[model samples]
Target: MANSSSTRGTSLDPRARRTRALLRAAVLDLSTEKDLDSITMSDIAQRAEVNRATVYLHYKDREDLLLDATESTMEGVVEAARACRLSVDTHALPDATPTHLISLFAQVDQHRAVYRQMLGEDGSARCATRLEHLLAQAWFEQLTAEPPGSPHETALQVRAHFLSGAVLAVIGRWTRGDFDGEGEDGGGGGGGNGNGNGMSVAEVADLTWALIRGQK
Candidate 1:
């Protein structure tokens, strides 16, 4: 997630941008097809139709490129989390799950396979840590934006950390098929008809929101 390649100025050449895009696409596609540890730089280069040296020019290593490719997919999740009204009075919150929350889960659902691999037991620690950081930062911003009576800074930090951890755990387990039997889709759910688990997008969202709000 701390790739120097990503920090390059917006003025990067068009061809460079195209090359980076191809490399990212290649890594992401390969991730869904095999275990990440087995994907080498040469594998990505071949898939992207670029020379091995070209891949090195853009990314320091395979992990750097993999993170860059996966980072783009979390933008929607971050935005949705930032927009959530986490500070609202529990009684006043809507009975229905917020559309933003649903969108957050849907965003993850769309990239389920990649996420499943990344957040699994054998997944990348960098990827998991980066996701947790982004989620905590998003929730922290939203909490700070609450009107005058918001919690103290330390309290906010605790809440943000708690939220991010909880959300990440839910997402990881969901993606790993831990919840495949929780809904009507039957055991071992894999079809996109649901969230790739047994629950629908909204159902999972509601469950997550309920847990966030400390409801039973």
Candidate 2:
């Protein structure tokens, strides 16, 4: 009992937590402001006010650091998604709507650099995969009331995975500024903003849910 408490307390120590925050903030700040190719360990150290050696101790290379940063951001998104699920039941939340989802997506657009980096040539598909996994886990916990082998379970899981991927894909495109006529977001072949008005996350969310549920 003593040992377990000691371990837990150590993990919660202030200085140790601060060091991690510094390193994580340094990586994300640099990523947000510059392309991944241009960032360096020394640059991160300087931005973070830490030593290069310290950075090395926490991460193996630029790729590793970028991955770590991306995961950190996903934690919040996953939580929001989980909340979306809970809101559906605990509060008799209204059916998922496109407008609301699109608005959440627009918030993601606010971090174009981070999303772009995740989908860019130098970025890690692994980060995207893990994020999808998180979203799937949240959805599964809520959407699946039966055991895995039930008649409808497999189908639902597949649909969940597909929905998660679609969400990520749209966000990826948005980050790259590819929403053609999609307001300030990029667009190479994007159709005019949904319904010809300014882009909206709520609309996208509604559309996405429609697709996932096969609704008209």
Candidate 3:
């Protein structure tokens, strides 16, 4: 594995940035057609219209590039989830769309194909583990940021881990079309923009909030 420091930098030059983008795009495109394990550096380079050595210059290796792309997408997911925590009023009832929840879903939807492949049954364990680790870390930070709620440190850690795992599982299921259009949310289907089944994003948020608050 690469040290990350060797390949990761504070900033990328324009040409470097362009090349990186191309390589990333290539990986994403190829991922849709083939499994990540089968997709080699040569495949990525060819798709990106670059040389094998060029791909090496930008990324440490195939796994490194895949992780980079996965993290980039997860960044948006984490940002949206964090925003939902901060912005949504836990006290107040949820609206149909639930701004933050939909925003989170939209981020996933934007990269639906990538997520589906990575989170699928035959998905990469490394990618799933990385996502779980990041999610747990984010939730742990969120839990600790507020005033003390849990009596024991261990309990808090457990709760955070539980929430993170549950959330990831839900998202994975949703990507697999488990909840498509089916809104268990009592009210009518989507808040107009929801899926055909009318599952309101707010309903999903409320359910998540309920679990979170109950555990607290």
Candidate 4:
């Protein structure tokens, strides 16, 4: 995730900004030819034109830095969903739609190398699980923001956990090449687009969002 400078959108301090920019740039450059584990803070510092201490000042460890980058990608996803008001039916279409979810997936696909690499075998699954928890937290907050609900936030939390797994399962399969041609008819297994044809991302997103919105 990007380190917020201030509520007003002021840029970060020049030195801090420089250090961060360097680290980000270093990751991009080295990732092209080296294993993430093989890259070191010193290497990043040199690439960024900074020093080890400077790298240390901004991030705790290499994993921490990588997590920051992952957040950067996720930030884009959330932004897109917001653009469509994922919460509202402004488009007058289903909660999920081919044009909508595919657009988001396409963006993620744009960073396929980074995502596929970071999502080492079991890595993406874990990342998706964590991401779902964050979503659940946000969902819970929204639930509690107004009057008490009939089913309670705890119930919603459980639903969120299951839904998170479902979402991850779809993404995992897609990454493994399971849904290449699934399209809009392959989401619900066994073909027919959950009974139609090709499992489309927007369709799956709609299914996922339905669960989210319908949670007790």
- The candidate that wins on lDDT is 1
Name the better of 2 and 3 by TM-score: 3
- Cα deviation of 93, candidate 1, in Å: 2.6
Per-residue C-alpha lDDT of model 1 across residues 136-204, encoded as one tens digit per residue: 998888788778886787889888998898999988777666776443223225533453436667777
> What ranges in model 2 sit over 4 Å off?
1-12, 86-107, 146-152, 181-198
lDDT of 2 by residue, 1-216 (tens): 111111123454677567767877887788776766678889988998988887776566766766666666776566666655522222344456534355556556445567677766666677777878887777766667544554476766775686678778877765565554544333322222343343355555666656555567
Model 3 worst lDDT run, 10 consecutive residues:
183-192
lDDT against the true structure, per candidate, is 0.78, 0.62, 0.66, 0.52
**Candidate 3 lDDT tens digits, 1-216:** 222336867578999988888888887888667666678999988999999999889888788888776766787777666565431123443433346666776676666657766877777777877777767766666556655453366655776677678877876666555565432222122332365453345555566666655423
Best by TM-score: 1
Sorted by TM-score (best first), the order is 1, 3, 2, 4
Selected candidate, larger lDDT, 2 vs 3: 3
TM-score winner, 2 or 4: 2
Which rank order by lDDT, best down to worst? Answer: 1, 3, 2, 4
Instruction: Report the backbone clash tally of model 1.
Output: 0
RMSD for all candidates, in order, please. Answer: 3.3, 6.5, 5.9, 7.8
Clashes of 3: 4
